[model samples]
Target: MDSIKVMMDIYKEDRSMKFNIFVILILSLCASLFAGTADDPNLIGWWNFNDGGAKDWSQYGHHGVLRNGARVVYDTERGMVLHNPKAGYLDPNEGHSGHVYCGGERASIADPCTWADIPRSYTVLMWIKSQMWWTPPWPGSPNQFEKEWQAIFTKGTRGYGQLIITTVGTQGRIYFRARGLQPSTNDHINGNTFIDDGNWHHIAAVCEYDAVTGQTALHLYIDGYEEYNSPVIATGSLILCSDPVYIAGSYGGSTKDGEIYMDDVRLYNRALTESEILTAMDEPIPSDFTGDSKIDMDDFRVLAKDWMETDYTIASDTGGMVAHWDFAGAAGETTVPDLVGDNDAVIVGGGQLDGNGAAVLTGGPDGPYIDLGANLGNVISDLEYCTIFIDCVWDGNSTSWQRLFTVAQPGTTEFSTITYVSVNERWLRYYQRHNAHDEETNASNPTYVPEMKGQHQIAISITKDYGLYGCTIIYIDGVKAAFHTNLAPCSLDLLGQTSRNYIGRGPFERDPLDANTINIDNRFAGKINDVRIYGRRLSERDVKDIYEGVSRQLYFKLEAPGNLSDAESTNSKVVDFKDLAALVNKWLQQVPLLEDNLN
Candidate 1:
């Protein structure tokens, strides 16, 4: 029967009135669903060290701060981990710092750093991989790396108890030591396996102490299994000192000359069983594939519908291009054509076409530089938003500024308005100045990776609304690392008086007033792959696709809910005969939900 006819029958037989209010019930799941909800209640401190930071994931926030070059860096294979690079810092507990400091301030009712001091029984666990080598025979101070037994975790600077590494280099094993019985005497335990072979090993030390009898039992676990046990019953309590805790490098101790990576530092209030320890290592399941409760056939149903459908798109926003320099030319050819615009650039000084579609520029003063003509002037003069991408390799000049490309006033002796980009082994500066109003952006990640090595994609985008609401974004490879706004209000103007642009040269140490001087130079020495200038700011998604390459990805979509199988009314009841009839009518039909990916 039709919905209208059913309504008429219901109106005629008005003896029974019904009201059914449908509600959506949502499930509140914690971020640690893979971690097992059973473990969180006992977890005093948990730091996964993913997403490039050491923020405590427990209900109690005991965030750790990075000090002395102790960086939270991302590796393509290892994800995010704490990287403590070699011992070059000045000693007496060192300089060129390499540690994550968890202060002793009581943040929660039972602070993770403080509770160990009042402990009954607990477990300290972490995962570490070493790139350390044996460079013993100390020079001046022991604060410099004199041994491979660098500390991983300790209560105070070598205070109370610690879980450290023993032996040297590739044959290193786990060691746990703490003060016991007397203030001077200490009790210790060691693991059986040598873990310094550049592989991540999960290590845990458990202390079971009986205060009544003053007896303490120490146990060590490696990769979810018990590897060592010591039945040393001591008279004194396990002394947890008053100083703050350090991860990766001990307070006033040594670290690997190479990177010693550590992650997922967790502290538990009680001794966890072998089974619970394994549960803690569970990988998180990505459940938001389609923004639904779980990933099922419904998620892929749209993908199977049509091959021509374009639901997913990762296209480059190359539509509003201002200037593009491919630097394609043969030897003795002075001109490099601007692919987007007709204005071609003239090569000055010693520059050669590498025959591989790239330009290899010679370094220092009197180096090679491509002088871009009026090609970008027309578009950039009226431009409010600008996005630029430079694909280049670093030639390693950390002492002075080395330019990637520069755009400034041509004939003016005094350097005022300019737009410049620089990349060296240690620094990256994306600067824009309009009438001396400067705006600059730097890479936000701990490791300045974009120009530290081989040919990589580095992008800087300036976005603006109608008002002064805008920011500059820095993208390394494809990830947005920084979104910065200039300290003073800025205007985006690349061509102030007349545009004079050059590749592989900077104006920082040039003539006293003029940045376009050839007299003194801070010219770049690297190979230039390509350079792009867009009139409009490119979106983060587009920058990602530009670097990763847009491919055919299936775009799955679904219609609004409550369509049911057949019952086609807003207030249709679930237990109705019409619903069953409608369900049977479309029993074997396929759903048209997903579309194919497009650029």
Candidate 2:
């Protein structure tokens, strides 16, 4: 009986031990999943304000104490942002009222010595939005202009070691100060870029301290680009004080009257590389189907099946896409094949396919241009309803009026054309003439200018109602830039006219009196990519999608196994089990490196 009891006790002990081991294993796995990696070992403090309180999510335990109504609020555009509403204007008598204070007993989980290291380098990153420009006044300082400095973050006492960051205005300027023992030799750096435009902007300040000489090098980055660099000079030893760090409002007892919103405040013990900063600013690609933060295997598979194809198809979404000149062909191929209709464009003059696979059009009479033969009746018949999308890069050669796309009958004063007028190289003009009424009318949008040396996506939509006046809307890079109503009732008709449509050159000559001559003076000097024309008006959302590079088609032309052309097709082949397997292999392992930058 004693031996049997002993065996039973051993069995029970073994089971309990196994259970304990299993629980430990599960806990370790969970910790590893939730803990951040050592990729940013210098990251000592991080406050995302996502917990609806002053808790530090960095696991650094540097909790904050919110004072004077400073609280975390939900922002539609941004997840959770710190909102510091002003109590009142700077009344020297009232003292500083609102701010988030962190440090002391809640000192960062990281070693405080590293932060105080004289020669240590560090980077501070945060996203801030503020409209008012008012800084807390320094105690006993009578200068009211000093109140214009709005503090974003600060540490240390007034006469001791101090570090301060503040914004001057909405013009993208920032001012930073790092003072050591000697206040007279304090380091001051100013940023040139503007960020106070009522929008959320990523701001980073990097400081490299030379311990040997006590010299500091400072650099300011706005939206990932370095906007200012201070000259290296002596600024005394950077001593870390026992005072806590204050955010949104200054440590000094003065209140800022305006409100400010801040999010994702981080402090790194080392300077972050430019590439890392860029990675931080980049927003995750919006996933449509899976709702994942990245383009995982599932999303990639869906994108592959409809690869390279646009969402709007010729036969479906976009009504009657008469012409679609993709300008994609062999390296030197001059002819641009029309993807939808039969309006293929024949490249004229000295034209060649550029490295970017665009039709490079030079300026002048001999410059390259596309000839869309006289049969554009399907596109311009009604003239009242039509949408044209063009992707091009301007060369900044504003010597003469440049014709982007135009349609007109040869030797006739009655025609419609889109041109970049010479008076304001940035303005885009649409002119139409009705032969029946012998009237010529024009509409221009001054703000629709393309960046001189950058790529631009332009969409023009024209619509008309029977009794109401005709309307023309111009969208640049997906955003509507201008909307104009026709001065007179819509009477323009290009139906049966023997019209000549051209891209990069005007059908009418420079001499307005002689309509028969070709106007080489207004030739476009730039690269032209996918140019599509629809006989019906397109919605603003449709234009925005196209601008953002959301396509539906996967394959331009079917190729046999191993003979696939990477340029023509977005996906190598149809998505199947192999693609699924690849995705499964990656699984949750493909997280973005900059996820720490966001809340």
RMSD values, in order shown: 19.9, 15.8
- List where candidate 1 sits over 4 angstroms from the true fold: 1-317, 328-334, 411-424, 448-453, 466-469, 507-520, 551-599
Residue-level lDDT tens digits of model 1 in 1-599: 45434333433564242111000111123322423542477776776665367777766677788777777775322346788776554345554247777765344335455644535567778887766342222111111123445677766443434333332332345667656543333366654344543446677777667767766666676666554234344556554555556676564445433347787788777777667777765544232223343323332332233222332222332345667877667755667787867767776786767666777876776678777774556655655666788887656663256666676665543222212234335356676665556677766355434445566778877654312445677777876656565665443453454466667775444565665664346677777777888765555545666787652111112122212333332222122334334332331121111111000
Cα deviation of 495, candidate 1, in Å: 4.0
Worst 10 residues of 1 by lDDT: 18-27
TM-score of candidate 1 relative to the true fold? 0.39
Error of 1 at 269 (Å): 26
Residue-level lDDT of model 2, residues 1-599, one tens digit each, is: 35334323534676664344334433443345335522355666777675566666564566787777788885534545688876554435536656787754225435454332323577788888764343221111111112356678777534343566876532235776666534444466665444543456688777777667766777777766554234335465565554567787765556332367888788777777778777666643122223222332344545465444344222332334667888878878877777877777888888877756698988764477888767765456654456789999877554567877877776666666677766565566666665444222233444444443558888877655312455566777876666665656543343335367888887665665665544545688888988988665555545666788754221222321221123322344443445344443332232231122111
lDDT of 1: 0.55
CA error at residue 329 for candidate 2, angstroms: 13
Model 2 lowest lDDT segment of ten: 136-145
Candidate 2: segments with Cα more than 4 A from true spot: 1-30, 37-42, 57-60, 76-79, 86-94, 103-119, 130-148, 156-161, 179-189, 196-200, 210-215, 228-243, 252-257, 275-360, 365-526, 530-599
Residue 332 of model 2 has an lDDT of 83
